[model samples]
Target: MSHSRFESIGAYLPSKRVTTEELVSQLQETPEFDLERITGVKERRFRDTTPENGEDSFALALKAVQDCLSRSQYAAEDLDVIISCSITRSKDRTKMYMEPSFAGAIARTLGAREDTISFDLSNACAGMMSGVYILDRMIRSGAVKRGIVVSGEAITPIAETAVNEISSKYDLQFASLTVGDSGAAVVLDESVDESDRIHYIELTTASEFSHLCLGMPSDKTAGVALYTDNRKMHNEARFLLWTDTQRNFMEEQGLTFKDEGFDYIIHHQFGAAAIPYMNAIAEREFGHPMPPDLNVIEKYGNTSSTSHFIVLHDQLSQQSIPTGSKVLMIPAASGVVGGFLSTTISSLKV
Candidate 1:
């Protein structure tokens, strides 16, 4: 069986930077908590909505894919699959699309072969990792030679709603204010050796806690909104779902957490405080200190499905993570989903 690895990575952050203070100043009622201190989001990127730019979900995906392809050995015509894992599917200004499938649209735009498999999947913020998992399995099974897992999140509309509707610091919509816009893509193909390959990836969903966070048309507004019970979603038990699942998986393989030898760990950029707390819990549960945590939340906030790849691309771009470093990515998404992805990246570059 062939092991799959990341062949290339790409990310695009909008040029418009909105500071936390600027974002909170729009709130009708001043929040009691320190937004920047709690979220570690001093600023975030807002997509350019100008008619000339047209940087919607589709456009964002296109730009990231272009960047990825620029670094990849394969062209669009050589790709066997394209998976779109974006939660927000806006194609036009505030206009959401579900029909022709974002994957199909991207494939057609990029001029991929007609036989190239294309589809869209949504698993909340775990969407992109879920895409990688599926593609990795497909490659291992020899179902395809190569594929692209891509997401373009134009997710700030929820923040707009939060600014308009939040009544206090305790409002469920408060969490929505942390979101930013971004596009990220990764090309995956068979690995030649263990030095550059995805060792394992797994995801689990605890449906009972699915109600803790939800995105829907606003109950009392003109746009979409996100309602997240951060108190419940970021609790100790909720965080344990990831460590516990990984622990079981490791035991089944006769391995310990430290046996993986990860050089860096990347968590979903939900909040600055929540990540350290999650890592502390992991240390207690796994009986080992975690690898260094990497994140861009202070500048990019939570970019939803694209968060992990964005962090990877950022670190690679800055040459902070060496080529052969093993990285661990943990996903915490709505649907109360949790997962761990371990990989050693060597040839992948942003």
Candidate 2:
């Protein structure tokens, strides 16, 4: 049996910056709370929208994969599978694509083999983690040798919609204001030793809260929009889903949270304030002091499915997370999804 490890990592963040002040200034309704202080999102990046040389979702994913390949031991043709997990599939500027999967297009453009398995998977903000889970299972099952789990979120259009449609502080599109655009990818291959391998990866969806957040066409205008009942989505009940599931899993494995020895914990970058609160809850439930929380929401905001990898790549680039560190990644996605992925990373670099 083989274990999968994050072999290499890559990311692409747009050079364009949009400050929270600028973003909120465009809102028709004045906010009662300090958007920047509450969300800790001072600024975020926007993809280049130039018609001639724009960076759409597909383009961003391609760039990220190319970057990943540059640092990876494998070339495009060496990948056994390519998983594209973007929530937004914008290709030709604003045009969305449904046929010819983003994974398929990405693999073809990168000159991968004709038999290369390419597909798209959607699980809200947990998309990339879900891809990693699948690829890890494939590697462990002797189904595949190497694969890439990637996401390119050109998701700022929801912010544009929130700016135009928000009529009150409690509006459904309020959470849309916290999104940014980014692309991230990670190469996974068989691990040679216990120092670099996934300990366990699991996910479960709480379908009851699936309606708490949704991305759909605007109800009031002619653009894409994201509606989230922020109050319900971030409540104590929702946070408990993660703690309880993880606690039970650890118990079943005859281990305690402390036994995992996570050097750092990466939660879904949903909010700056909510993350701390969630960590507090986790500490109380697990009876252990949680690891230092890692985040990039202050600069990149929430990049949807790409948020986790973006933070990982950023920290690795700055050398904040040292090699051979045990990392715990928890996913909090819109399907009311909750899961934990524990891994010891050694060779993953950005």
Candidate 3:
């Protein structure tokens, strides 16, 4: 059976952006927290300039899909499946699953066929990658012909909630500054040749660390309340959670950090600090420094599961990645870690 492959990928970020300095200045004026010292984030993206009624995850998803379709020159009707992987969704006045049919709303907005397979996938931060894996398997089995996977993370609400909770509980100043907002989309097709196919994809879960990074809403109607497991909400646990999973994933692939086999390493862009930690771990395990192209955290922050594909799209457009280059996509969600290694055979150039 022939495996399905990704023909093209696209990403869309909101026009409104926030820099760390700006965030710090605003926080300092309020006296609720000192955001400069504690937070590791230097910048983040938001859908709306105003926090109250900012752009929503669904809107961002629409924009991302539109970008992907336009860039790939593929019409919405061409899609056989449309999967939206998101933690944020439209809510009713009572905060219930407003549309219950949110996926249908997305599909209709994009002009997808009435028979198109459309649904939502929720797996914390691993939704995007997980969607890709599922679609790949289905297409390979000839269950689908072409599909689209999209992710939109409107983390601002969660970040704001975290900031308020941490400030009220521990009197901390910089807790909310760490979260970032982002969204991405990828187009998959069974018609693509095998030469451009995904080489290997792997996903693993360490349920033991499930409590390490968690999101709980103080009130069911409110946004997420970020907290750490072990009753110690520190950054160490977050690092350990990601590092441990990454190590296990690499070992499973028989890949040592020292191997320069991959031209680019697209990791979960957690933060600037997380990138160095990943590189250090890779060097120690592989006994050598990671390749130069293995970095994307500095600019995009951590886009959860979309981090890997976002970097993949950016690098492809920058001429930094050449055709037929091998790329490794390593992503870790709250409870799962996934690794996808694929080669670029099609010329991204016009």
Candidate 4:
């Protein structure tokens, strides 16, 4: 049975970083809301928008791919597949791209061969993981040998809209202010052994809660926007998404929290408090608490599709997470789509 593993990882954060204090200063007209206190995001990187040295999503993705390639064994033409999972494609900063696939364009720029299967996948913030899920299945089925999943999210437009248009604390677009911009890439190849291999990947959607969060152009501001019903979506029901999707699988495999022996839990970096809240809920429902939670929300904010990967990269870079560590990841997306990922790594290089 052929399985896949993340052979290498890469991430790119723009040089322009905005502290929560700076963000607050930008919205001086609006009443104060302690952003850091609310979302646990002290600062977040933003793609340079300066004309002389700015980067579109495509450029950011390219840089991330270069970073990935530097740490990988494969060259440009060696990849069997290249998946682009960015939610935003800033072709010219005025429009989001959709005609030719961003993945295809990225591959072309990278000098990848024509034989490479280049495509794009979007599933809200679950976009990158969705690509991982597909590539994992393909590798297991012997349809492909190597692949790369990458994403570049320039989500600050929504934050710009929210800062200028928000009139009161009750505005639905409050969540938009917490997002940042970043690019991430992961290289996957057929596994040689148990170490550094992906164990499980799946995505479950609760469409019933789909209406709770939305991203669109702002009616009041010039930039894009996001509106979220925090009261309804963050309640007990949304947190139950993981359990509802996994009960059957867990029953069949006789897997419990303690039984899985996950050394660390890296949930989507939506917010610092939300993860701990999830841990408490899991303990109440599953009869065992989750493992120690790893996060980077304090510095990186929510990089959307790149959230979990950012945490992985940060931990691995610092050597805080040793090889053979049993890692469990949960992805949180606005479509109310989410799932768990398990992996063990013998060594994490970049």
Candidate 5:
């Protein structure tokens, strides 16, 4: 049976990089600020040139998709599916939903056929993985020959708000300053040779933990109340707390603390603080130290769903791993955790 394979991957980071010092300087000038700690985040990328109003997630997806098509030999007309997976959206103050429909706008921007499959998947940080799995099933069923999964996460605004709120409430300075912005894209197709395609994908969920990390719509009433009560800010710490659950899931996958059966490991970036713990767990389970370069947390920060693809794109561009290498792409979303094991097939060279 033919299998779905990732043919190419691409990523785009905004030209404007805002360092912690710069952010602190700006914040200090305001009445609500004071001395702060930036933790380990050196800087984060922001769009150098934005639309008159602003560049939303859809626009970011378009630019990244264009780059993907240019780097690979694929033409716009050859694409059979387009999936826009992002946590952010474009909307007006009065409008309830984002304008232009993310999937439709991306399809038009890429000159894809009207009949081509197009849609948006909002799975928080696991959106891209969900999109990939959906497309994989379609290709396996002969519904489409080629598909693209794109994510444009301009989480800076939310991060900014979350950080400010967290800092104001808890008197903590480092956590809010570590968030960053990024975008990424991936191209998948049916592989004529099963040897070069996605081999296995396992997904598990802990819905009981769904409330751990959440983004509630802003409410004037609650906003005013939260300003005085610090307890509300504690939810922001959910990302850190979720690490224990992720470790448990990894163990269940038979990926013991030190197993090295997999040649490459790509995971969602949570920041420098989380990397050492994950690396240590992998080493303990695998019985060997993970390569220093295995971590991408330092540069990109935490990009939610785009984190894994960003690392994959970087590794592929550098040819860091040889063809036929076995790589594991792992991502742990707020309520769900997923593991995808794929082989770097020889066909990827062509």
Candidate 6:
């Protein structure tokens, strides 16, 4: 079987950035709370109704896709598959769009061939990673030669809803306040060499803990809201969530972390503090220091499925990552979904 790897990546954040202090003013009776110190998010971007850039999720997605193609070896019409995996959807950020399928809509707008397979996938913050997993399988099986897994996240509605509904600093929905609006796209194609291939993509769901976090309509607001049990969902025990399976897989395959040749680990951009914690746990599981963890949460906050790709795009643009680098993309989402993708980015055009 062949391998699949990311060919190019593109991302966009709203021009209007809101500082942590500024966002505090919008919350009700939260004067004692300090978001910047707590989450390490200095500021975050939120999309607004502006002619400069379209405010809707679809518009953001289209722009991101166009930019991704501009950097990739393929054109929009060359994509054999298009997957849209966003936590939120549409111009009306609150209403989820499933009928036309955001993937098909993007393919149509981009003038992809009629034979292009397009659809949407939802896996909480792991949506784009899940899309990548599916496309990897398709490409390796010769079902598709090239594809894109993209997301345009308008998740700030949850924060807006939280600020209005929470009366105290102890609100469970507080995590939602750390999100920003962003769009990210990745162009994936068959790997042409050993160093440019995806070694593995894995996703494991601990559905038993699913009740600890949820996204639903706010009772006091007109927008959607996210509720999370921080104590229950992000405790020391959470490290065991993925390690059990990973340990067994390592033993079964007789493969070690060093053998994987991972130079960096791009984790879910949830918060500034979370990355180190996750790395400590991962290093313990690997019996060695894991690659330096990479993050962009300080500026972009959590953009759900777009988080990993956003960080990747930023790092590459900064030349923080060089060719022939091996990377591990990890996900830590609400479904207690935890997984890792090991790939060599030496082949990614960036």
Name the top lDDT candidate. 1
Please give each candidate's TM-score: 0.99, 0.98, 0.81, 0.96, 0.77, 0.95
The TM-score between candidate 1 and the true structure equals 0.99
lDDT of each residue in 230-322, candidate 2, tens digit only? 888888999998998989999999999988889999999888889989999988999999999889999999999998889899999899989
Q: What are the per-model C-alpha RMSD values against the true structure?
A: 0.8, 0.9, 4.3, 1.5, 5.2, 1.7
Off by over 4 Å in 4: 28-33
Tens-digit lDDT track for model 4 on 1-350?
A: 88889899998989888887787676635545566887899988888988777787887788888998998999989999999998888876556799699999999999999999999988888888899999999999999999899998888888888878877757887777778898899999998888778988878998999999898877776678899987787777898898666655677888876787889988888776677787888888878867888888888898998888888888889887888898988888888897888888775576
Tens digits of lDDT, candidate 6, 99-153: 8899988998899999999999989999999999999999999999999999998
lDDT of 2 at 139: 96
What lDDT does model 6 reach?
0.84
Clashes of 4: 0
**What is the lDDT of every predicted structure here?**
0.93, 0.91, 0.65, 0.84, 0.63, 0.84
Q: What ranking emerges by lDDT with the best candidate at the front?
A: 1, 2, 4, 6, 3, 5
| Window of ten residues with lowest summed lDDT in model 2 | 167-176
Model 4 accuracy (lDDT, Cα): 0.84
Candidate 2 residue pairs in backbone clash: none
lDDT of 1 by residue, 1-350 (tens): 78999999888888999999998999888888898999999999999978787679888888999999999999999999999999999996667899889999999999999999999999999999999999999999999999999999999999998988988657999888899999999999999989999999999999988999999999998989998999889899899899999999999999998898889999999999999999999999999999999999999999999999999999898999997899999999999999899999888875
* Clash count in backbone of candidate 3: 3
Instruction: Score candidate 1 by lDDT.
Output: 0.93
Displacement of the residue 344 alpha carbon in candidate 1, Å: 0.6
Error of 6 at 161 (Å): 1.0
Stretch of 10 with least lDDT, candidate 6: 89-98
Q: In each prediction, how many residue pairs overlap at the backbone (N, C-alpha, C within less than 3 A)?
A: 0, 0, 3, 0, 11, 1
Where in model 6 is the C-alpha error above 4 Å? 31-33, 50-54, 92-95
List model 3 lDDT by residue over 173-279, tens digit each: 23345656667898887646545667556566757667667666655346666554422323444445544555666688776655526666766665554456656
Q: Over the full model, what C-alpha lDDT does candidate 3 score relative to the true structure?
A: 0.65
Q: How many backbone clashes does candidate 1 have?
A: 0
